[model samples]
Target: MFEYSIKENCLTNKTILVTGAGAGIGKEAAITYAKLGATVILLGKTVKKLEAVYDEIIALGLAEPAIVPLDLKGATKQNYIDMSSTIASQFGKLDGALLNASTLGELTPFTQIHEQVFSDVMQVNVNAQYLLAQALIPTLLLTEKASLVFTSSSVGSQGRAYWGPYSISKFATEGLMQVIADEYENSSLRTNAINPGATNTNMRASAFPAEDKEKLATTADIMPLYVYLMSDDSLAVNGQTIKAQ
Candidate 1:
């Protein structure tokens, strides 16, 4: 796992947004950020799950988190625009955004890939990310140091036999990260991708049903990379796809 020695309250007064905040790694990241003194915005499709996380954050006496229930699959460009505008209005600036929402789509041979499944994965994994970032750029740029973290996988860089749409979407994700990072190289905004290797997430279970979950790394184990990318410590690192294993 990527290791970093983060101090207490490292993220104080920072307002960070996390997608897929309802469960798994996203849930851990959101709570972790709050614990570190960041006021987090939990963005996810499930209201109940978001509420659960929100309640947990409040109970822990951490920063109060907000919930934005949104389904990336069906959200429009205007939705992202408004969301970004609201974040700017309410928070003054967005210090970081962890774009972690994604779909597994069935793993299948390239020739056997279903049209609908491919479209669904691309919509959530690629298009929504692009639109959200586009809308959030102005707000992100407003902050002195802004981190934009995109989630990736091992298949993002290399092709695998049964990964299909998920693999192709991750390749595009890396491409997107590089393009934005290069464009914003000298700006206040920093862009990067984190390929969280084989964590014991619900998504992981679906990907490898037969594997033993006990041996896989948990969300807590991979958060160092997550925190490092979002902290000022990584200001010099951009346009890189780092692996958390």
Candidate 2:
């Protein structure tokens, strides 16, 4: 678990949108950002889960959060564009966006991979992100300083057997981050990826059911890096992949 003294009110006047905010790392990050005074937009597939997170934030006396129910697998370019428009109308500008929602298709041998599974994984993990980023860039540019954090995996960095489409999608994610980072080198928006190593999340449990869960770090433990990336402290850091452990 990583720890850092969070500067009080570091994210005052900022608006950050987090995908997959219903649970796991995304949920924790949203809570942390709200605690630091950032207005958060919680996006997820399940309305119930998003509402639950919303209620939790309210109970903690954090800033009120907005909920946007969306499933990455089914969202189209127009859907993302509309979402961006709504955000612009409501918040005026976006300070950051965490592309945290992802789907891990069936893990199997390359020869046995199902086409539908592959397509679904790529849709959620890759295409959806590209579309969302494209639509949100205009609003992001409105900020004096903005950040975009993409969720990546270790297997995406190193090809591993049985990792299947998830790994390939992560590689694409890394590439996307680099391209965006380079394109925005002189701009206010900064882009990067973070690998939350072995966190005790549902995704981890699904990927490694046989492993001892107790040995893994909790989602809250890896929040410092998320906070740092969202803060002005990491303004100059771009095109880099950080490991949060």
Candidate 3:
């Protein structure tokens, strides 16, 4: 499990947007942020899933969360613009964003990777991330200090055999984080990437169906890094990849 020294209620008054908040790490992160006092904006393709998370936060007596049901694979520039505009109008500023939505394209050899699968993976993992960040950068700048944490993978940092477009998309995600982090070096906003290695998410299950799920770290186990990256504790951390395992 990851470790970080974040103080309790460190996220009070913060407004954080979390993509793919319908399930898995994104859901856990949203709940965790709300518990720490941040108003969470849950974005995912499934409204029901987002609503379930919202109810969980409310039931916990945490800050009320907002939901944006968006499928990144089909999301457009205009879609992101509208979301950013809504956040700005509602929250006045965005303190952080967990760009955690990603898809696992088939784990096939490079030569056997399907064209549509490759495009879908890139669209969701790369294109949507770029468009969403481009739209939200202005809102992030409104904060005194802001964080943008992009989800990465072990395969992204070091290519693995038979991972196909999922690995490639993650590589692009890392590049995107570095580019944005460098460009925003002098600004109030900072960008970083986190690799949640070998977690017990559905994606991991899909990748390794035969593995014992109980042996892997759960989403709750690795949330310290997520909370740390989004909190003031990591205000000075930027343009680097942090491992959460």
Candidate 4:
């Protein structure tokens, strides 16, 4: 499982939607899927960043990708439903979806947590994911085999001192994954979560301001696990939380 390589056409004839695709792990995952022959839908809040990724994928002569500018913080259920409908009409089915977008609200003490801050965190991390997954389930079921990967965190499994809302949101994410996984236990769609441990992303930098970025793994280095989870080879592996190091 650790030594697998994504075949050049492993994801050929498939379509994948990746949230937070404008930067960091999301951007890298989107590009990786395109390189492995999947038509990728890049969803993010920034149009320019998504376009940059789109252009890079095109330049690589990989699959052509689509761009969806979405702000999960403000996105409504209807927006997700409409997007899902459009995807169903255009692609017929969605092969996979990476729910990678997240917000790292203020890392304050739990005692000082405010209402708006907590709501904002939960909105992007939990509420939006629930809505998006609900909308995309129909399209995912249409696929021969489909994967739904959520981005989890270390704090989700074990509470930490200063992680606050981000931590709570991740805990909710894991709970959601378990609920959805159980719901689809007998179906073709599989749901799972991954904790990209201490990677070299802006989020990491923000979370650990004093840490040395040079000591951490780059986004590219951790993609094999992401690719493996999204590929057909992992068809039997579902409903589990994995660490991508």
Candidate 5:
């Protein structure tokens, strides 16, 4: 598992947005960030799930979390604009964002991949991220320091058979991170990518159904790096892809 010694309340007064906050790593990261003193904005497709996470945060006496039920597959660039506008009006500026939401298309042979599945996977995993970043970059610049963390996969770093469009989208994700990171190297904004290798997420279960999930690392196990990247501790780290496993 990854290790990073983050100080208590390291994210105090920070306003961070997390995509895919309804479940899995996104849910855990949202709650964890709130506990560490960052006001979390939870964006996902299901209101019920987001509300559950919201309730958990509130119950724990953590920073109040806001829920935005958004389906990334259909969200337009204007939707992201409105989201950033709302964030600016309410929080003044966004301190960080975790672009963790992604879709896993069928694990089939490269030739067997369907067009619609390919498009759907690319829309959520790559295009939505691009739109979100485009909209949030301006708000992110308003802060003295800001971080944009993209969730990557092990297959993204290296091509593998049967990974299909999901793998291709992740490769695009890594490229997106590096491009944005280089673009803002001289600015307050920082972009980085994290590969949560072998985490016991629902998505992981879907990808490797026959594998024993008991041996996989939990979301809590890899949270140190998540918190560290968003906190001031990693302000100098940019454009690099870190593996959390």
Candidate 6:
């Protein structure tokens, strides 16, 4: 498992935004951040799941979390800008944002890829990320130091057969991360990507249905990297894709 010695209350007073916070790695990260003293903003397409996460945070006596119900596929740039403004108004500044939500389109031969699947995958994994990052950058700069993390995959940096649009989108994601990191090299905000390798996520299950779930690393096992990226500990770490294995 990835290791980082996170201090207690390392995220105290931080206001962090987590996309896809209703499930999987996103959900775990949100709860972990809250426990470490951040006021978490849970963004997801499902309102019920977001609410459930909110209640879980509250139940743990962690910081109270806010919810933003949004589907990345249908969200417009204006929607993101307005959401960013609301976050700025409500929280004063955003200390971090985890761009963890992504779509896994069908796994098919290159020649067999559907146009709609490609579009949907690109919309969620690339376009939405671009717009959201654009809208949130200013607020992220408001903090003395901030982290903006994009979720990536092994296939992001390497092209593989039949990975299709998901793989291509991740390559774009890594590019976006690098570009933003370069632009913000001297600024308060830093950008990076995380490649969560072979974890027991729903997406992973769908992609590799025959795999043994018990053998794969759980979200809890890989949270050190997640928490580290959000904490002040990683202020100097930027433009790198750190793997959580």
Which candidate do you rate higher for TM-score, 3 or 4?
A: 3
Model 2 over residues 140-218: C-alpha lDDT tens digits?
A: 9998999999999998799999988999999999999999999999999999999988999998889889999898888
Clashing pairs in 6: none
How close is each model in CA RMSD to the real structure? 0.6, 1.0, 0.7, 1.1, 0.7, 0.6
lDDT of 5: 0.94
lDDT of 6 by residue, 127-212 (tens): 99999999999889888989999999999999999998999999999999999999999999889999989999999999999999
Quick one: RMSD of model 2?
Answer: 1.0
In order of appearance, the predictions have TM-scores of 0.99, 0.98, 0.99, 0.98, 0.99, 0.99
Q: Quick one: ranking by lDDT, best first?
A: 6, 1, 5, 3, 2, 4
Candidate 4 stretches greater than 4 Å from native: 1-3
**Which is the better candidate, 1 or 4, if ranked by lDDT?**
1
Q: Write the per-residue lDDT of candidate 1 for residues 54-119, one digit (tens) a residue.
A: 999999988789899999999999999999999999999999999999999998989999999999
lDDT of 1: 0.95
Assess candidate 2 and give its TM-score to the true structure. 0.98
Clashes of 2: 0
- TM-score, candidate 4, is 0.98
Candidate 3 backbone collisions, by pair: none
Clashing pairs in 1: 1-245
Tell me, by lDDT, which candidate is best: 6
Better of 2 and 3 by TM-score: 3
Can you tell me which runs of candidate 3 are displaced by over 4 Å? none
Candidate 2, superposed: residue stretches over 4 Å from native: 1-4
Model 4, residue pairs in steric clash: none
